[model samples]
Target chain A: MKDITEKPMQQWISKDNKAEKALKRVKQNTTARIGIGRSGARYKTDAFLRFWADQSAASDAVFTEVTPETIVNLGLFEIKTKCRSKFEMITRPDWGRIIEKDQQQILKEKCVKDPDVQIYFGDGLSSPSISANAEDMLQVLKLGLEHEGLSVGTPFFVRYCRVNTARTIGPLLNAKVVCVLIGERPGMQTDESMSAYIAYKPHPQMLESEYTVVSNISRHGIAPVEAAAHIVELILKISKAKKSGISL
Target chain B: MNNSEQAFISAGIDIGTTTTQVIFSKIRIKDTSGFGFIPKISITDKKIIYRSRIHLTPLTHENEIDALAVKELILNEYAKAGIAPSDIESGAVIITGESAEKRNAKAVTAAISEIAGNFVVAAAGGKLESVLAGKGSGAMTLSKKTGKRVANLDIGGGTTNICLFNNGKVEEAICVDIGGRLIRIDSDKISYSSAKIKECIKNLGLNIKEGQNIYNNNIVSDLETIASSMTSYLTYCIDPEMSLPKEWKDSPNTRLSNRPDIITISGGVADCIEKITSDSFAYGDIGILLGRKIKESTLTNTSFYQKSDETVNATVIGAGNFSFEISGSTIDYRNSTFPLKNVQIIDIEIDNTASTIKRKIEQFCSEYQNSTFALAAEGIKCPTFKQIEETAKLISSVFNFPEYQNKPVIIIIKEDMAKAFGQALRRKLDNNRQVICIDGIDCGIGDYIDIAKPVASGQAVPVVVKTLIF
Candidate 1:
């Protein structure tokens, strides 16, 4: 077979020049408006510290950074963050969901053997919304569950995570339920909001019926605290009903 | 029409990573004794009454499995045929490549079963790839004339499976978990940043800004780059082990026979065959060739089978054919036991809101005049373990329903949260009722609930439910 250069190849090679010009225009326009916040420039540095402070002050649940060395228990909570971009969310669901395989191993090493529930926060397509709303929601959820005399789990943060990853980790930690608070794909009206998706016996092959969802559960739509109250109620109902999402 | 007048209708459902296919067929029966009896009279022609196709995005998020996509596809296909959903007879669902790998494969299957209001069988685990390879080869043979045994390779969106056949019998098969869409392209090495990729797309004049605007917008240009990178990786990975005759080395791109005999490419990535072959030495026809062979083998085999005469809708056609096969049969042995004197199969449909479980029980009792000896309700979703207990309570109360007073109810609830819900139900039942939990993939409750004799069944036992604590 002769190695003929097809039309798709031509398009690929020519994309570089086109991308450069377009990128320059976008940078100029965005810089003029959003001004690239300090957190944007130093995402892993100062942002981490601020996130830690907020997380620590918001809840008494043991908090840990999702690093390679961090250990995860069955009922532990984890979250992922990413920039407010849909392309990244659509193209990179795996990145937003599961922890890096090696990092998952580290979690196994440092965390408890098994837990009752595992909660994760992911930036589905809106990092800012997840970071802002997730903390308050978590705090309220903890208070409600604890008040109901249900044991609370450890909580952590994930960078660029998706909803399924929480389910994947839930089974690994022996958790009966896994909740993920993530930024929903932003619409024109709002870019700073998040949602919570809770699943029972989450694994790679869970069905929508096995999950319970509380969408628009953020400060901008449903207040984080209020959302937390609903989540607590839903969780209780789910435990009693033994179902979630569409099945309910 | 006489009482003996009958019609054969079948449906094939293919759940791929990027899209789902549904096909329908109607065959006339001159006389009807029964399905297996092969009517005493014969008809000369079988016509395709309806055909429909749709492209869909894979369920990547946990919350995305609302069954709306499947529902829309099924309903639209029925509408296209100008028939109601209940009018459809039998159907088969083939979960190939990515859909089979989803975390909620069982739940998705159960949901579809409830909506379809019929028995739905999912080809999963090792069976998916094997059946796919077998069926794919059968599809290819419809288009080509080949005497030699060949291999069929299906390059889908997330994975690739290769099957070798000799004289229409599957000899060996292998599935590789790498696909075209999933090929990671590191832009940093290509002189472009993530920001640049988005900019280039915007420059294409799509007006797509940040966030949710990304979906439904064409990113064909960006996809081209990703395709190029993917081709490079695939070529590097499969080249070494690819068993190709040396004769085809000079014109390897066109020598489909020596390379794979017949490659039938299905799934979302197959749509980008042109891109995959460009800037690389591989050929796109390799996939098609494989598809042809698979199709041919299945048709030629000596077994109960139905083959498609058209191109590009094999999965749907297959599903439709299977649906007809089931409808024509006497009883659904897969979903219910035989000798229907003592047993009954009760299917329940629940909504996606609160109090659905309670409502399902109400609906069940209002519909059935007598207490069912065995109850199996499909499609229940509860978020927490607490909900599972409530659902079990509702199932237990079914015995108290006026029609079911004092009747022992062996209740089977099919929900996505089978493991969690099962645990919660077991705790609530705790010696009060006989509660058994069967994993959807492991055992079909309809097949086991009314077993005449008690034998050890390989079912997942109910374990105590636990939560994740940090």
Candidate 2:
């Protein structure tokens, strides 16, 4: 393995020079890597270094914890899945889908029962993603729901969570619709990408097709405020159709 | 609202010196984003549905445009096209070349654009007229296909507009008062000649006056001298001995470093030249003779002449298709006070200090009469949380100034950070004033923007950047 402290080779050779301008124009229109000139059929030093850096960022996003300030700023109480530790949470994904009995009792006592809409923030795989996007996303979601005269239930954050956590809480709080904003699996391109999974009348036996998802909610992807706006509209459409995902 | 395909009716009308024409088109806008992805709306298709027959521009006896007659002509064509004025959603109306110099030109153009329905109709100057004609004549595409520079010479009734295209994009342009109808011939009688034409006649050492019944040989040779002078302007980038009009002298060439690869001719004169008719009295003027002389002129430059796809109707077709842009779907703005028109857009550089941002706003306040100005900037490149917060704080500080305390702050960023920046700005302002911040549309200083209300998706707004000042 290359030394983590050393920088990669950054030089690129070109005779035409105009190719550099054309490459810049192409690069501005897309996020995909293009025009990274090679050296003797090998990757350039900068390119190799950038690849490793992004890989480390993706892993760091998965291992880090959500900041306490973010939770407090959004006024969200904490909950945890049945998984005891981060190692066990990654090894046994099934445990992350189930809330413990004690946590279920806490949710039932605190959340508003039979609400029109319930919202959740989960640090699925990337804690930094939630901390980066959750504040603005939560505010917009609340404002949009309130503007349409729909009551939102008590919101909370879940640690070591999964998308199926919504399935567990929907029955406990008796929510008509459950929307969970969770961090997506980290990719080398971006680690802060988040996804919003929404289900109408979610239950334990609900198929994956019954849940609608809006992925790529981040600064590098869709702006969080715009994502919330889209989510509000999507939820309204799902409610009117009484369906989601493929059905809607 | 259904997230499906939506179509809007658009119109393009060109009122030039010699002819007036209109074209109606249908633009199909749809959400191109895939399932489970953020919405991305774009104009996927444009089809010309109706093309009006070319009509002679109505002129008054006093040498000005006949406004009522022009209005009636457009109305009659709309009736023939089987569409009401309300059918046109967006498009442009260009009063080009000599027609733009008429006494009631602005009013007539504005009225025609208003009559065409809810569309943008602004008069275009010579430079823009040349670019539009080149785009309409397919010279732009030809340059792109060959990967070479092409210069379009649109020779109309009163001026020859030249637009240079390098790799399918317009680089520079110039328009000179050299055209076919500058010398009017009425049944062998030299009935009238513009002052510019008389100067050319004197330079050619020909005894010609307004009332002389000149022979065809004398007029044809005189037309050849004038055509050679125009070609010399194209070749040398400078007219010798002020043979052509001197108005465009100060507007000199900066892009003629090397000879263009190809030169294409369009407009009415080009139509007559390509037809190659023997009769000199065609169209009751020396237009045919002038065209033939221009074609036969010996240009020493290496540029080769090529035929254009469109001749007389180039500007009209280009005005129809190339002026409107659909904004990115995910924009941030208030819906209640939209469909704004004629908003002056001022370009700003991203400032690092709060005082600089205030100074920029103050400079804009002193420069323009309108209280509301759209500030455009190349926003934060990465748009991280810290960058967004700093940008928002700077903008909110400018808005909080005493001069613009209660006014709405409008920001137009070139980057895709409009929503987040707007949200941050709102938090900073504490919802004190209205803020409309939209991105995904690139515009520069001195360009006016017309933003329509949000479409059915309720996320994006249709935008038209009006090049009114230039």
Candidate 3:
């Protein structure tokens, strides 16, 4: 990768000063590609190169895998989905949402029964987001819930996971509320953005609106430590309302 | 729109030396944090809903402010606007120019503030009034729109308030005892004269006194001298350290870094002067003549004199607008600990050591002599859960000392970790003491912040940040 320049790169070589100044002001607030000077109705060399660089980074994030050392550092035991490879998980999304018959017995033996809140961490699309924010976010959230005197179940990690996996895992653990924190799809703006999907009671027949989601958890968006406090408060509201998602 | 997005009613009352006016406005607050994120609440829109008819400031026998009459006037205006006092959420009452010197000015301001309902602010200062007048006159917005430096001269009844705006922020402000109502003309004789006007007359060697008729020979020259005095001050022709006129010596000098590209005149005399022709004293004063004199005098440094959106009601409109700030949603607070007024924010270095934090707290306590203040730390260094916990422990150690015991601890952080850090501190400290922690407000060291109680439907609070230094 090549480093970009610190000074502003002006796009208008023909010299409309007012338009150039306006573009500069807009560029200060956003990272989207804009105002790149064109050469004969085509993007300039620098702009083309930068676009390719962002695309390559987004591609890399999708194929990456969470490391074993990271799971051990966060003190979480890992579980596998029915999908064996990244290719299978990407093409067959339904396979990633279910656990095998043998894995269900293991889940029940290791997890607490009838817990007030159960939390899960998974690498959905970008492995960097899980490795970057999950440990700190989990630590702060666990502390906050304990302060509120709520019973939190044993935390675990899942491999090749999809969002719908909560529907199968919730019933097996007998949890009243289940929250899944996973990486979001990578975009040119950021690759480490994360999302938290929470459901009151997970079942196969639950509608899409039955899940309440909080997304864009990153350093530039919502700081992971700050997001933890909001997550705990949201769980309390879900419990008191006896509902989640659009119903709450 | 979400349930937290609601509109609030605000009212602004300006009690000036020559006139009193009222304005009501509506402010819209909405959550913009988007889906699946912490709610970042902000005020997105403001509109003026009502503009009251301008009224004369009623005075008592001793020329003091009549508090009862003023209260009745406000009540009538609210009734005319079809609003109850309880409907007002936040606003300000500003006493400007000569009215600020009245013996009962404080009492009148307090009376209006109580009558205006909760969250209404009471303020009396020349510099703050100058800045507000500039904001209301559209000088601030003009600077932002045109990207040019703007200077506003608010020539009201008793004083000429000047404020310079660059990039939509107030750069400099100064007030001088030069205005349209300084000399009141009744029929063909001078009915009333201020002491400052007497000094100007003596400086020009004019044979004039109270009750004397101004002949045609000296009237134009006298008015020209008054107008030129104001122009010379704005153009920097008058030396502030040595040759500043005695009338302006009491007010601090204006400090401008660059010459303004546009000059705007607001307040009561602005409309009359921009037309440049008036025969009669319609307001029973020298306002018309003063306006004509000011029009004739030229400001050599400025390129253009732009028209403002407001004229006489500039201060009241500014007071109604631009008077509140909404806090971020994730603040740590209890319902009983709010509506804090005039709390000073003493900024400190973001040190992780507990001893350094203790020293700064002790130094602030000794300097302020046990006055209640909020500890405003800049963005935390390395904002992780462990780092935030360590900072919280450091704060608890400083506030739990013998000298600072039992005081409600107020902490303001610049980052979004207020809830995390606040909860950690609460768990570490004794349960007897109260804690109020807020975030997402980045204020300078000398600034003062006032926090109002949270709104009924939203958890976000309203904050007012002010810098009163000249």
Candidate 4:
């Protein structure tokens, strides 16, 4: 028993050297959390709404905070947003797919019976950076859409939703097109960000080729409003071409 | 090597969920006839001179008949060892898997009982049968060798059995419902289903139905799915909530560890040796294969035993060995046993006297549809006739109530379904009162009587109940 204890003790004391090496590696490749709440609840809802409102208002487009029920009547368009952490984003994909059952029932009652288009904005894993860059991007998007005379759908804010949820719910409500704005996974050096993913004929099992995406839409990266304008121009091109991804 | 030289052969049989195995040994009989008829004489010169030929019966769908085949195989092996059935000294049987729990398990035991009638039936008699059923020879051998408590976890293709031994004696054993074949795999990531699993087993050309609800003959994929699921369960089993033994927790190599002493894997999955090393080199199959060889020889000596070709014969061998051990009386193998007797059943009935009075109130609400008095009520702000009628149609469609499609109808119920319908209506109508289910008891007065005043007065919230009324 004494021999057994001594051998393990020697191994433990030597493990400090290994720990020091691990610490050095961690410092060289830093990963940070940007917009997540300390508590597990949806504490970042107000911040998300405020950011969405400012961005939409700056672009001359009215933004309304609607439940899953209200969104069905708003027709379809694209959504945009971001998140701050990788673990928070990956573990909760199902939470962002659809509204709760009770909310879904309410939407069936008050919203339009079924609309042609439905788009959503999700914060994915980098909400903080996406929110910061949204204002400038929306202005650019509005101008591009107007220049092409494309009739965009009503826009609104969706909290804690994912990009895929737009594809899933869009077809259920008979939406012809659905787009989502979500934040990309953040690396060590960069934090401020957002991205837009668009799809046509969206449904539960739509192919990846049915959509398009634009990443790094942020102040320190791609200018937010400018990226939004580029996205709108691409949307017009897709609508004229009647296709997306490899097909276009 | 002289004419007077005789041999005492001892054998062990293990009948597993997916396979059967047997093992045998022949020892020189000193100062006694090799036949088991005479009493044993203490002799230090006696020693095992030669081992009998190890044999196995192929598994088959006609497993009922396969037991006879196993007995014949055992007989042949005994002959090869230069001994007759009556001449063999001792043996043991360990039954396991679905066969042990079959409705005709007793009948099968009775049929095999005659073959080893001379020897004590260790597995068939008294309370020891169930206890010794799944205790493969591994645990038995370990117990005898270590003189300490040891447990054997027999992992088969479709099920896993855990048998424990203490102080060179059998204790308790249990079979967990999960197996290697049940684990699920979606590409590289392995996971388990929290939902019920339905699987089907096809033996030879005949499909044998097993599991919750048998659908198609796709046992291989189902087994893989189950095995993957066990990986997750193995993880959960180590949790403190599960109350696993402290030894299991303190060990650094739990489940996926490479420590050979901590755990051992045995069965069909163990054949994938590379996979075991990477995951946790904790599996072995030698004990079962050795058991199978002994059973085959026991059956060959008995004239009544027959053979089959569909399955890896292990159970029959186990059964044969078990019969020999009890009859030979070389060891007291009857400690663990369970008795079956005195079972009972019962039934119940209910009366329906209160339902007759509730029908009269429903009739009164129907008459108020076209009346001026009904329209004059406060909060009777019915939508334009078309909107009210359309709302009614939508409600009917949503609730699958096709009969009320073209009528200006109001539904009234006296049960819980009515309340659920009301809640559904409230949700669908956005708190509108186009549909409602009123609650009250009839006091045999006015046709439409309000037994209790409304709890809270508000606009009628449309509620849709989608339940079948009895």
Kindly provide the TM-score obtained by chain B of candidate 2 when compared with the true chain B: 0.88
Q: List clash counts for every candidate, in order.
A: 109, 1, 3, 104
Error of 2 at A225 (Å): 4.5
Each prediction's TM-score versus the true structure: 0.32, 0.80, 0.89, 0.28
Q: Native-vs-model 3 lDDT?
A: 0.78
lDDT of 3 by residue, A5-86 (tens): 3232333222333576666655655666677767899987877876777677677778888889999999998898999977
Give the best candidate by lDDT: 3
Off by over 4 Å in 3: A5-21, A28-31, B1-4, B61-63, B170-177, B191-208, B237-252, B293-303, B335-337, B352-372, B430-433, B444-448, B468-470
List ranges where model 1 is wrong by over 4 Å. Answer: A1-248, B1-6, B27-48, B58-64, B129-147, B183-271, B274-312, B322-470
Per residue, candidate 2 scores C-alpha lDDT tens digits across B54-135 of 8888888536788888889989988998989887767788887778887888778767876878765575777777777888
CA lDDT, candidate 4, residue A133: 52
User: lDDT per prediction?
Assistant: 0.45, 0.76, 0.78, 0.37
DockQ of each: 0.01, 0.29, 0.57, 0.01
Tens-place lDDT digits, model 4, residues B1-470: 01143444545454444445555544333323232111122222323333333333234452442666656655555556565545434454444554455454455445443453223132422123223332333445455444444443444434444444554454554454434334333322223221123321221122323332222455434443333334334333322243333222332222211111112223443333223243221222122222222233321223322221112222233233322211110111011111111101000011111122122222433654432110001111211222223333344443333422322223333211222223333334322233333321111121121111111111111111111111
Residue B172 miss distance in model 3 (angstroms): 4.3
Clashing pairs in 2: A9-A45
Residue-wise C-alpha lDDT for candidate 1, range A98-140, written one tens digit per residue: 5666667655765554555566666556655654565556655
